[model samples]
Target: MDFDPLPDKPAPDNPSGKLVLLRHGETEWSRAGKHTGLTDVPLTPHGEELARNAGPLLSGYDFVLELCSPLERARRTAELAGLHPEIDPLLVEWDYGGYEGRTTKEIRKELGYNWTPFTHGVIRGENSPGETVEEVAGRASRVLTRVLPAMAEGDVAIVAHGHLLRILTSVFLRMAPRFGAALTLDAGSISVLAFYREEPAILTWNHGPGLPLKPSES
Candidate 1:
């Protein structure tokens, strides 16, 4: 387990450390395919185990910055994974407003038409007033502002929920925030993003245990 921390962050061979994203393991609502936001839910037992195993994937690096959503599920996952991340409100899941505890299927059935958070939007709810995709993207931008600079020092880690991470990824890649819909991130999954010839690129996507996570070729 002897290794260098890659102190030469900008060495010719390795231009900068990668941005590693660790999506929190499954929660009751997430497992049920419900829109989870604002509400702080705990992880299922299996989710705890998943987070334990996910630790090793990130063990090799010394992250200059580690951030996690304040929600219990995300915080629990970060603790289990030994991330010791700072609480980042910007990393919280997208505020689903009135849809907090409901599923897209149910909402669409009730509305009598197809709908999605990115397309149909959400209504004001008791817990949250709902946020537009643009608003979500703005938060993602703020996160990047702090994280991207840290990359020059070493890798940065983020332990958070799904939709927020995907939206952040889109913003990092200079894609429209709605592009997040095309990216599927599963609970307990790991993803890596870094620069490719001066442009942001995805080095790995939706990686999980029993899978390969070789060094980024970026």
Candidate 2:
């Protein structure tokens, strides 16, 4: 077969990147509504199944890189998702500090202050175990800035915690991280961010096993 040496092909149009953001599956803490941060817990058996199912659902994408939080839950979920992920600290969930392993209601009762990441931010003692909403947002922004360059031409999967991923989505769209408070990301759910001419667009939002895989196809 004879092939002609073609001239440069416009450098492939400077392809914009796609982000395949995946929230980790359920954990005992998650099921109990506890704030999971550095606590590092494993998924429930059902969560494991859900994570495994993600493989077939997500395998079709040509992801250039796979990243996951250093936390065990996120790491295990990434493993079950069938993607070998490179650990990135930026992908770690928000550090709940004193709130770790505790529920929102419990924290409110103890502190006498309504606490929420988007609302009150972190309440009390800020030594080293927890993170404020702004702190978490900064981490999300750092990851976003670093990953965007690598996203060109193909997709990138990031297996992480719900709160952090939500913040990341907001940051990627150039929105305030506090807006993530409005978003509800379920365990093992998948979201996608597409770029059109360097502009951010949500190709898909929170979706998972029972939902239609693609919007048009849905």
lDDT of every predicted structure (CA atoms) = 0.81, 0.75
Per-residue lDDT tens digits for candidate 1, residues 1-218, read 11112122333443388899998887777877788888888988878877888899888887989999999999999899888989988888888899888988889999999888877778899867988877888888888877877888889999987889988888888778888888888788889999887678899998876532222100
Please report, as a residue range, the 10-residue window in candidate 1 with the lowest summed lDDT. Answer: 1-10
Q: Give the per-residue lDDT digits (tens) of candidate 2, residues 22-50.
A: 88887777877888777778988877876
What are the models' TM-scores? 0.88, 0.85
Q: TM-score winner among the candidates?
A: 1
Scored by lDDT, the top model is 1
